[model samples]
Target: MLVLAFASSVENAVQRQLGIAVSVEMLISAKTKVTSCMEYVLVWDMPIVQFGGGIYRRRHTRIFGDQGHASPTICAYSLTRNKE
Candidate 1:
Protein backbone atom coordinates (compact mmCIF):
# COMPACT_ATOMS: atom_id res chain seq x y z
CA MET A 1 0.00 0.00 0.00
CA LEU A 2 2.82 2.37 0.83
CA VAL A 3 4.46 1.61 -2.48
CA LEU A 4 1.21 2.26 -4.30
CA ALA A 5 0.81 5.55 -2.48
CA PHE A 6 4.32 6.58 -3.44
CA ALA A 7 3.73 5.65 -7.05
CA SER A 8 0.48 7.60 -7.05
CA SER A 9 2.19 10.66 -5.62
CA VAL A 10 4.84 10.39 -8.28
CA GLU A 11 2.26 10.03 -11.01
CA ASN A 12 0.31 13.03 -9.73
CA ALA A 13 3.49 15.08 -9.69
CA VAL A 14 4.33 14.06 -13.22
CA GLN A 15 0.84 14.85 -14.43
CA ARG A 16 0.92 18.24 -12.76
CA GLN A 17 4.32 19.03 -14.24
CA LEU A 18 3.02 18.09 -17.67
CA GLY A 19 -0.03 20.39 -17.18
CA ILE A 20 -2.45 17.59 -17.87
CA ALA A 21 -6.13 18.17 -17.26
CA VAL A 22 -7.93 15.49 -15.28
CA SER A 23 -11.19 15.24 -13.36
CA VAL A 24 -11.34 14.63 -9.64
CA GLU A 25 -14.04 12.03 -10.09
CA MET A 26 -11.86 10.19 -12.55
CA LEU A 27 -8.88 10.26 -10.25
CA ILE A 28 -10.83 8.83 -7.35
CA SER A 29 -12.28 6.11 -9.54
CA ALA A 30 -8.85 5.21 -10.83
CA LYS A 31 -7.22 5.21 -7.42
CA THR A 32 -9.90 3.02 -5.87
CA LYS A 33 -9.47 0.33 -8.51
CA VAL A 34 -5.68 0.51 -8.44
CA THR A 35 -5.48 0.19 -4.68
CA SER A 36 -8.08 -2.46 -4.03
CA CYS A 37 -9.03 -5.91 -5.30
CA MET A 38 -12.79 -5.81 -4.88
CA GLU A 39 -15.56 -7.01 -7.15
CA TYR A 40 -18.53 -4.89 -6.05
CA VAL A 41 -18.17 -1.25 -4.97
CA LEU A 42 -20.05 1.94 -4.32
CA VAL A 43 -19.02 5.58 -3.82
CA TRP A 44 -20.82 8.73 -2.71
CA ASP A 45 -20.11 12.44 -2.39
CA MET A 46 -16.46 12.84 -1.40
CA PRO A 47 -14.40 15.76 -0.15
CA ILE A 48 -12.03 17.77 -2.35
CA VAL A 49 -8.60 19.36 -1.95
CA GLN A 50 -6.14 21.52 -3.83
CA PHE A 51 -2.76 20.11 -4.88
CA GLY A 52 -0.27 21.14 -7.53
CA GLY A 53 -2.60 23.96 -8.53
CA GLY A 54 -5.51 21.55 -8.81
CA ILE A 55 -8.43 20.39 -6.73
CA TYR A 56 -8.32 16.98 -5.08
CA ARG A 57 -10.85 15.02 -3.09
CA ARG A 58 -11.10 11.83 -1.04
CA ARG A 59 -13.68 9.49 0.35
CA HIS A 60 -13.41 6.89 3.07
CA THR A 61 -15.31 3.64 3.29
CA ARG A 62 -15.23 0.16 4.66
CA ILE A 63 -14.34 -2.77 2.43
CA PHE A 64 -15.88 -6.08 3.36
CA GLY A 65 -14.26 -9.42 2.77
CA ASP A 66 -16.20 -12.46 1.71
CA GLN A 67 -14.77 -14.37 4.65
CA GLY A 68 -16.30 -11.88 7.12
CA HIS A 69 -13.17 -9.72 7.42
CA ALA A 70 -13.47 -6.02 6.66
CA SER A 71 -11.01 -3.18 6.20
CA PRO A 72 -11.12 0.59 5.84
CA THR A 73 -10.34 2.14 2.49
CA ILE A 74 -9.70 5.69 1.41
CA CYS A 75 -10.19 6.84 -2.14
CA ALA A 76 -8.60 10.10 -3.26
CA TYR A 77 -9.84 12.24 -6.12
CA SER A 78 -7.97 15.00 -7.98
CA LEU A 79 -8.53 17.45 -10.82
CA THR A 80 -7.34 20.72 -12.29
CA ARG A 81 -9.89 23.44 -11.53
CA ASN A 82 -8.32 25.88 -13.93
CA LYS A 83 -7.34 25.60 -17.54
CA GLU A 84 -4.07 27.09 -18.63
Candidate 2:
Protein backbone atom coordinates (compact mmCIF):
# COMPACT_ATOMS: atom_id res chain seq x y z
CA MET A 1 0.00 0.00 0.00
CA LEU A 2 1.18 3.48 -0.83
CA VAL A 3 0.00 6.73 0.65
CA LEU A 4 0.94 9.99 -1.02
CA ALA A 5 0.23 13.47 0.21
CA PHE A 6 1.34 16.77 -1.27
CA ALA A 7 0.65 19.94 0.64
CA SER A 8 1.76 23.46 -0.25
CA SER A 9 0.81 26.62 1.56
CA VAL A 10 1.61 30.07 0.26
CA GLU A 11 -0.18 33.40 0.61
CA ASN A 12 0.87 35.42 -2.39
CA ALA A 13 2.07 34.74 -5.93
CA VAL A 14 5.70 35.43 -5.08
CA GLN A 15 5.54 33.11 -2.09
CA ARG A 16 3.83 30.41 -4.18
CA GLN A 17 6.46 30.67 -6.90
CA LEU A 18 9.17 30.52 -4.32
CA GLY A 19 7.55 27.51 -2.70
CA ILE A 20 7.44 25.68 -6.03
CA ALA A 21 11.06 26.56 -6.72
CA VAL A 22 12.11 25.35 -3.29
CA SER A 23 10.15 22.12 -3.70
CA VAL A 24 11.87 21.39 -7.03
CA GLU A 25 15.24 22.13 -5.45
CA MET A 26 14.47 19.83 -2.53
CA LEU A 27 13.39 17.02 -4.84
CA ILE A 28 16.66 17.25 -6.72
CA SER A 29 18.62 17.37 -3.46
CA ALA A 30 16.74 14.32 -2.15
CA LYS A 31 17.35 12.35 -5.32
CA THR A 32 21.09 13.07 -5.10
CA LYS A 33 21.51 12.57 -1.33
CA VAL A 34 19.28 9.55 -0.62
CA THR A 35 19.76 5.95 -1.66
CA SER A 36 17.45 3.98 -3.94
CA CYS A 37 13.77 4.29 -3.07
CA MET A 38 13.17 0.73 -4.27
CA GLU A 39 15.78 -0.58 -1.81
CA TYR A 40 13.79 0.76 1.16
CA VAL A 41 10.73 -1.10 2.37
CA LEU A 42 8.12 0.10 4.88
CA VAL A 43 7.60 -2.57 7.52
CA TRP A 44 5.00 -2.38 10.26
CA ASP A 45 5.83 -4.91 12.98
CA MET A 46 3.14 -3.95 15.49
CA PRO A 47 -0.14 -5.56 16.45
CA ILE A 48 -3.45 -4.68 14.83
CA VAL A 49 -4.47 -2.09 17.45
CA GLN A 50 -0.99 -0.54 17.35
CA PHE A 51 -0.80 -0.76 13.55
CA GLY A 52 -3.16 1.99 12.44
CA GLY A 53 -4.49 0.84 9.06
CA GLY A 54 -8.04 -0.26 8.26
CA ILE A 55 -11.28 0.58 6.52
CA TYR A 56 -14.41 0.37 8.69
CA ARG A 57 -17.77 0.77 7.07
CA ARG A 58 -20.71 2.45 8.74
CA ARG A 59 -23.14 0.54 11.00
CA HIS A 60 -20.98 -2.48 11.41
CA THR A 61 -19.55 -4.40 14.30
CA ARG A 62 -15.92 -5.42 14.11
CA ILE A 63 -14.11 -7.77 16.45
CA PHE A 64 -10.36 -8.28 16.78
CA GLY A 65 -8.32 -11.14 18.16
CA ASP A 66 -4.93 -10.92 19.79
CA GLN A 67 -2.57 -13.85 19.40
CA GLY A 68 -5.43 -16.34 19.02
CA HIS A 69 -7.25 -14.74 21.96
CA ALA A 70 -10.22 -12.39 21.78
CA SER A 71 -8.91 -8.87 22.20
CA PRO A 72 -11.82 -6.40 21.88
CA THR A 73 -15.16 -5.81 20.20
CA ILE A 74 -15.40 -2.63 18.15
CA CYS A 75 -18.75 -1.59 16.75
CA ALA A 76 -18.82 0.92 13.97
CA TYR A 77 -21.69 3.33 14.46
CA SER A 78 -20.84 5.70 11.62
CA LEU A 79 -18.20 6.05 8.99
CA THR A 80 -17.12 9.49 10.22
CA ARG A 81 -17.45 9.02 13.97
CA ASN A 82 -16.64 5.92 16.01
CA LYS A 83 -18.80 4.88 18.95
CA GLU A 84 -17.30 2.55 21.53
lDDT of each: 0.30, 0.24
Report the C-alpha lDDT of model 1 over 1-84, residue by residue, as the tens digit. 111121134334234322223233323464454664333233222233357876543433123212111222322221121223
Model 2 CA lDDT for position 70: 22
Report the poorest 10 consecutive residues by lDDT, candidate 2: 13-22
Clashing residue pairs in candidate 1 (N, C-alpha, C atoms within 3 angstroms): 49-56
Model 2 TM-score relative to the real fold: 0.14
Off by over 4 Å in 1: 1-6, 10-39, 42-53, 61-84
- Model 1, global lDDT: 0.30
Off by over 4 Å in 2: 1-38, 50-84
Supply candidate 1's per-residue lDDT for 25.
38
* Candidate 2 lDDT, 24-57, residue by residue in tens: 1223354566653322223221122212454222
Per-candidate TM-scores read: 0.17, 0.14
